[model samples]
Target: MPDLSPAAFILLQGARVFAPDDLGICDVLLAGGKIIAIDSAIPADIVPDCQLVDLSGRWLCPGFIDQHVHLIGGGGEAGPTTRAPEVVLSRLTRAGITTVVGLLGTDSVTRHPESLLAKTRALNEEGITAWMLTGAYHVPSPTITGSVEKDVALIDRILGVKCAVADHRSAAPEKGQLASMAAQSRVGGLLGGKPGVTVCHMGSSKKGMQPLYDILETSDVPIGKLLPTHVNRSEYLFEQAIEFTRKGGVIDITSGIPEPIPPAQAIDRAVRAGVPLAQLTLSSDGNGSQPKFDEAGNLVGIGVAGFESLLETVVELVNGYRFTLPDALRPLTSSVAEFLGFDNKGAIAPGKDADLLVMTPDLVIDRVYARGRLMVKDGVACVKGTFE
Candidate 1:
């Protein structure tokens, strides 16, 4: 059953509204976890029972969707104690992330796909939508079931497989192995009607995956299936990622690196390079461990990723980098939705989920709504996970 109520509440009067697709000045009618209408004004008769919120001229944009998150801890290179703990619900909600795609990082041995699936379901039960990738960085590829194909087809929340590519820390699959994995994921997606994306983790290493050129040369999967993340971490890597975009692949810029160049600058560089803004997406590798490796490839320093960086990226884009609000918001909002094949997310259209954020011109999140319910109001969360 779809939410067909005639806007139980109408948000009238916003100076600017980013419906995740474009910028406009219009009132949004929200009801029953879905956007019922977007019009100049609602009928007077429908106003009494509905809750009307006056925006006082603020920007309303679609809530953020983080694609490359370590949901249940993604460390272990340092030691057993270095593993990150499971992410808390309030951590994500307060950061304005209404949707997230979790993945396993280095320690797939200790943390199994079963644990990842359980954690995802738990988050979903708490009102935040959660999904996970099939495997970690290893070649054998750990799965809840023995096979990656089974995991993608049988597990409703499992979308695709993620591997470490072009990094010293990577399993570094040969060209043939990478193609076989992509074939398995593509066939599974076709069978289950799920996104068969092969999410790749690009690192700072200069020895890139020229091997993947084989899959690009011949494969039924569109280049978009290869979701290469963290492409903006290094200067050369960012250029490689831009070239990938030219080939129709979606590149994810991570917001968690503890480096000299910030995420906003990376985004600006991509824009100035003439990369399609729609082909780029941003994610806060939030709640994960950001390890700084010494020349010996050992962790010497570490920084924790902030859930708040998601919105902070928007602030830096608009304030520091001089990007228009619409330009800054598009990648984090609509671009992510399109990359992950989520039809109802990342938009404020009539039939889309009413997941939105209200913020001042200064980029402070004033309120948030997911599935058409008010979760945050006046910088505080009204709804929280049961675990919280």
Candidate 2:
């Protein structure tokens, strides 16, 4: 339930508004979790009791939605000692990630889907909208009640199935297995009216997207069903991701550190290379471990991906890379929201959820709102779950 104050909260005077529909010079009225009105001005006396916030001609955009994140623990390659801690609510709130799709990575046995679901619910109950992927790195992916198809179709928050492909730690399911997963996901998505995608966690393997291409060529599954993430991890993988976008499949470029290329450069190159704008999405891979492996698959070092990197990715795009806020913000906001079936998210509209971020001229996250509730304000989180 959302806090529906009898008074309509009014946000006045923003420098620019990218409300997805390009609504200009409007004041937004938020009541409960929904925007009840958008106009030049609201009657101040009508909602005299409402809280007032002045933007002072700063940028206001939809809060970012991270589609692929390891919200729970991620690594286990270095043994039990290497398992990452669970993500706290404030970490996401401060970073302006109002919505997240948590997933299990590499070690599915140690961290199951049920635990992921519980964590997601904990976040939701704490006020931030959260969801999860159905499966993990292995082919026989773990599930709440078993079966990726059934889990995605029948489970409430289970939106899609993710598996490792072209990675040493993965089952590296054959093209046939990939096709079957996509087919089941497609049907499940249709049944649930959700985007049923086979979110493939691409590895550092030089095989590139050959298996993906094979699956697409042999199966009746639509190209939209195949989503290859971390496509910017390597030069060849980045090129393959762009090519995949050209062929109608969606590609996710991670904001996490790239092995050889910087993430900003990869994004710029992808855009410059003319990849379909809508086909491209971005994620933080937050709370997950970035492990580097040697030739013999020995773990040499590890780095953690931060939620703040998501906003930093946008800042680099707009300031240094010459991309407009609308262009760079889309993949982080509207594009990912639309893909994941979060209808009320990723846009500013009359009836849309009041999920937003207030940024300074330098593109720093000043405040955040999830479904009309103020979570982060003035560079600090105002609301957080008890677990942390």
Candidate 3:
């Protein structure tokens, strides 16, 4: 509503701030796409041209950061026709996701790293922060420059490499291959100054987490470097993840799980099981295909995932499970941001990017700001994609 463009100066007043850790009621000033000041009050005369908005009844928190998404769309397992469509900007902004980490899933052949990089740039152009991972489900995984190290080192937007392990669709790489990939990513991260994490897509296979365990037992790759996602797909997988987190590794829970343990419940279980809260993160897997396969590996049904589920899970954690607001917000915000090395994102503070969300008491999104630009106001999107 506030012109749908980046504001030179904007003041959000009287809001209960979360900085993702409850900063009490405060006035936040945004300028040059960063939070310049946060205090109990900011004199209007100090910045005569600043736009002032009273958010007395709203709750302000750091914008959500979704770590795993298919920006250019995922899935080709069923066929070319079943490839998920590209995600639009409004969907992300409306869902309170100000930053996203894009990746390719089962089909890196049809969807190239070039396209992923281009889409990430496109999102940034539209005023959202976006980064990506290289490779897909195969070992000898595809890369922009023919190697994982080169891709992470040279590509400014590429943060790490993504591959499937212990899944039916995975390359089923031997332990040596897994260690080599992990080493390459670690060195690349060190040289490039990026997180350089290996984002592994875990599956429903009975092998569970054995491959990752083998990698840890036999190699020097730090457990932190191995980020296994979709750990909540089943109770058994979730149990394995609980152990992994207890050992100082991080596990990513997908929001759109089908049955036994939904992501919110998974978090509850993980907390009860004594897994470190800081070691858990959540992702939407948005725009990726959720394909159900028969015993013979035939695709029987396919459903597209939605990014909105991330916020929905957060709300459930707070309102239904009685988790504190800050605890409910961590996995969606700071935890993911810290793990992904997004230094400027994941929190609302004086030096952080002006990515903030305003929510009503009932947990509905009332407004969203990304890097000092208002994208949604009063739960309505004011900005859209080039084609939307």
Candidate 4:
């Protein structure tokens, strides 16, 4: 029911725009899968036969860019039956996530990087934008190609590589290996026209972020190229995250974690401690298994992360705290776009992708757009996966 031609023009009028910068009330024009114009007023006739949608009371915002997700599902801690299900199209769109960077987690042996690539393509065809990282939690990380460099440079949809550390589940790749992989990813990004950043999965272990610091101290890898996620897992780890941020490394706070204080408060503590907000980002880690362990390292409980937390955390940052709308949106929007080196995303500006969201006064997602396509409307997904 949300069908529209790829090039069709749509005019949204009288919307309170966030552009993630609080543009006040404005009209936005969309065409050719890009935002053509944004101004105080644009007559309906400005573009001949453009479909006009009235949104006088809605808040228009840039759709979220969830940096960490398992598009083909991520799990396996509980056993073979615990692997999560593949992400369907509506699950992402309805959650207001317009773009995603997919990856594999702990079980790369059974789940291949090639399947993740296929899912990325599938998401694009399903009316949203998607990219992926190669490898899992293991060292000598698995790759579609024989090497990380080849995966990043040759694979069009692959942005870089992924690995884990500081937990019992990780391969515990040495700092030398970390530095080498980061360097390879950076060079691959240069060659492939993508941000070949290494996405490091941080676990809640006593080691915290020491491996990253060691890599920085002993190697030539730039601080910006390493993106450590799940920094909000514990209080002490969050402290290390602050230190890493002060040292100019980008830290990703996982929003789906429900323990050790809320992610919004963790971000607030970072801001109070003089950590630059631009260096911080928030991702859902959606579809990944969040397994809890006792002091004995036994799995006590588990839950699958979902895409909803990105929107929920953003709202909390504003209404529940001192953050302005733009500041609250930075992590999931501009900051993420900047970190991923995506030129056409993260803001509601002209020349950007038409990935916009419409929200009600109380912060419910009302309508959504991805690549200029109406993927969701009235808080429900209008499009679905092929098998759905």
Candidate 5:
């Protein structure tokens, strides 16, 4: 469980704060799990009992928000033994991910919605923010409340639903079915006061975004309601995603895609092609299986995704591609937090949750604070999950 001790004030000095906007050298004050003050210098005499840490020469940025993850484990395409293990707490904090959105993937049969919900709550208790989408690859997808609309409207943890499209594993529902699901998700989001987006898993099928286009052409569902992921899986799909973003829809690029356009390169391409940065986001399909299939449609090899890839991609965007720190920070931080409706996350301004990362000049995470508690200090985890 989260450390529930009486609130302690913390004063950090001499850090270059990003707020993701390069706030220059500043002193930040944290108390009661929130950022209470950020200034050029906070008077130490005001809070005499506060603990002070000298963060000179370190870079401080908001903690990352990974919008797509398999918290309860995903996969089972090969066999029961191939199901990936659940993600532990240290794995996320070490990678600087303070908030995560979990989902069921290809193996919705073996993993139920309740299990996903329980695991989300478990992560929250372990001291991080967590939320989830209700369904998985199958349409008429599995849910805790039996109906998609009811699931989002009633379940506080559920922000939306997910389904597979244009993939061999997907049920390949008709266009009308897709429209109905989108409608239900939209209504559920309206009732629940959340972004009831239908997160679509885009596969490498030749259909290539036609299903989404058909839905927009036939129904009244707005373009913003559908979020397609894995757009970097193939060049053709990536182009289609860029066009979708230009048309005011959001697109999510997965960090683990192999070959062709990698996540960093894809982001660069999107920026150059005039895609609005706000409409683009990146996610780590962490703890889910990354399978390779033979021409005959058999799963020949399987590998699991790691959460660290998310941070690695961001680092590459800055160090390798010459992106400004704030530009590289957008997709993983502020953009995602805004997309998911997390009011208190995504930035380091006052009144935001005290989820901040202290990184070395080279971008290695040196310390991590989530909700005013130090989770990692000097590259080592200070707090670990119950079973970790």
Candidate 6:
């Protein structure tokens, strides 16, 4: 039976736990939104009213984290008529995402960063963990507090700043400018005890991944401090992205990319090229615009990104590409949590948040618990967004 109360005890027994590392048949105990015990005999001592779910054959894993999303939705690329509608909570939970990092995209003027911040808060209030980056594609990021450092350091929900490079739509920030942003983000994160990384949306352009390398060559900022996303969007960019990982920088490869091969194939290529598998992570880029352009640089078609593709990518990594369950899951789980300094998430360990998924052996999501609250049951959302 599912427990609807936030602070009620829930005991799950006889499940194969992939604490993201295959801890075989274990019993998990959750109380007050935290995992109180794992692989223990604590179930024998639970109170009578505790919700007991006997999972003799199901698999338990940490919930997925999507590190890049336009929570308030993104667009205005094709025009005002093309702006995407904001994401609702049920849409995310149904896709197995229990943690998300929201940000603005190319349309900062109409879709403000402050609105993104508020949406991040709404997701939290709706029963999932949420954080956001505090800038858009331009340098000198439009922030709630007038400066990147101030926004990141003072705002509890803000982890760092988001900016774009190597794209025609970007402001074409130089190496010095990027380094400066990274430095400020680092300082802000240090002050706020956050990750403080500058999340750069790598754009499709001739410059490729060179701007990050330029920043590395010219500045004292650490490679880890600069997290570049959309690395696998093009063959040239993917090749350079592999090199970036070799240089010890973490890169986010977007799922649902219009690529010749699946993202997992690219991951396999990276692994063969001696890149540490842990340095590569996955994000949905959900609710952002997928604009098609002609050679004349005009928008020809547009569509909205779906959260299901992120889940599909994980399944492909496991079933199609033959990645182990734990390996396939780490990028969307533990790795994202590690990158964002989310100590309480990404793993099914004692003292960690009880954000988890119950899955069938065939990789179907059966149930989802966010912060110990049962948000999804029987592959359908039992909870919904406020207006949904």
RMSD, one per candidate, in order: 3.0, 2.1, 1.7, 1.3, 1.2, 2.0
lDDT of 3 by residue, 1-388 (tens): 1244577889999999988888889999999889999998888766878899899989999999999999999888889999999999999999999999999999977899999999999898888899999988988888889899989988999899898987998988888888788778878888899888899999988888888888787778899989999999877888888988888999999997746688899998898888766888999999999998888888899989998898889988998889888999999888988888788988888889999999987889999999989989999988888778
Using TM-score as the measure, name the better of candidate 2 and candidate 6: 6
Worst 10 residues of 6 by lDDT: 1-10
- Segments of candidate 4 deviating more than 4 angstroms: 1-4
TM-score, each model?
0.93, 0.95, 0.97, 0.97, 0.98, 0.96
- Candidate 6's TM-score: 0.96
lDDT of 6 by residue, 1-388 (tens): 2334575788988889999999989999999999989974555566767888887789999999999988998888978999999999999999999999999999889988889888998889889999999989998788999988988899999999899999888988977888888788888999999899888898778798888888788888789888889888888888888888877899888885747546777777777788776787889899999887777778899999888877787788888888899988888988888878889999999999999999998889999999999999999999888899
Q: Over the stretch 13-96, how does candidate 2's per-residue lDDT look in tens digits?
A: 543566754565567778877777777766655565677777766677898899888888788778888899999889998998
The local lDDT score (0 to 100) that residue 107 gets in candidate 1 is 81
**RMSD in Å for candidate 2, one decimal?**
2.1
* Tens digits of lDDT, candidate 5, 323-345: 98888888988888878888899
**Span of 10 residues, lowest total lDDT, candidate 1:** 1-10
Native-referenced Cα lDDT, model 6? 0.87
In model 1, the number of clashes is 1
Q: How much lDDT does candidate 5 score?
A: 0.90
Query: Cα deviation of 181 in candidate 3 (Å)?
Result: 1.1
lDDT of each: 0.78, 0.81, 0.89, 0.89, 0.90, 0.87
Candidate topping lDDT: 5
Cα error, residue 39 of model 3, in Å, equals 1.4
Indicate the TM-score of model 4: 0.97
